[model samples]
Target: MARDYNFWVYIVTNEHESVLYVGMTNDLARRISEHRAGEIPGFTADYRCTKLIYYEHCTDVQDAIAREKQLKKWSRSKKVALIASLNPRWKDLAPEILGE
Candidate 1:
């Protein structure tokens, strides 16, 4: 039997919630951890985007990537509205994902 895999389109923000980032990954938990640990370097690290605010699951990688691209193209206020729709308080969803 073939195993199942899930792809994700996610949003994360800095502690101040001033910087928002959009990304796609196969492993949400690991990816968020990388952002938090600053292990990947670059924008997430530079912006200190450690809070996993919103995420959507997709069964197809193409769909996830497309969603990520769409979100990336959205205006900042639009993105903020999207995030608020799912995460009103902009809570850190990392610990939940990490199973803490």
Candidate 2:
């Protein structure tokens, strides 16, 4: 028997709900924590896109990366719709990741 790993494609937004960033990670919780802590430098850090509003899991890393690319190309409205479909309130899902 073997353990399987999951890859995640996620959308993170800023406080004002104006900016949306698409990303992929193997450890979603740790990655989100890095965003929150401002440890992962670059656009996400500069723009403060720390809210974990949307995510989809895939067993394949290539699938996750493809989904991330697809999301990055979508219009902001379409991205918002996608997030709202899963997280209507646009809640910070990082807390849920910690079982809070």
Candidate 3:
């Protein structure tokens, strides 16, 4: 049987907003929590990019993955513009996803 699932393309930044990380995940809230907790020992953890500044929803997993790859290839200024357009202040949006 085929099941419809939700995928999310999300961006997280460090405390100084000097770095950005783009990723796709099936569970946005859980992923963000992992980032916040520094559970991953890679880029997000190394750079402390735990603030969820932006996200988008896609019903198709392929689309979400493609979007994440595309964003990763984007220039920093372009990525910052994209985030600023939706989140001008670059605020941490984890609470919304966390249902807090």
User: How does residue 22 of candidate 2 score in lDDT?
Assistant: 96
Best first by lDDT, ranked: 3, 1, 2
lDDT of 3: 0.93
- Compose the digit string of candidate 1's lDDT tens values, residues 45-78: 9999999999999988888889999999999999
Enumerate clash totals for all models, in the order shown: 0, 0, 0
> For model 2, what is the error of residue 28's alpha carbon versus the real structure, in angstroms, after optimal superposition?
0.4
- Candidate 2 lDDT score at position 25: 96
Supply candidate 1's per-residue lDDT for 35.
Answer: 92
- Over the stretch 2-94, how does candidate 2's per-residue lDDT look in tens digits? 778799999998999888999999999999999999999999999999999999999988889889999999999999889889999998998
The lDDT per prediction is 0.92, 0.91, 0.93
Candidate 3 lDDT tens digits, 1-100:
9888899999999989888899999999999999999998999999999999999999998899899999999999999899999999888899999999
Each prediction's TM-score against the native? 0.94, 0.94, 0.94
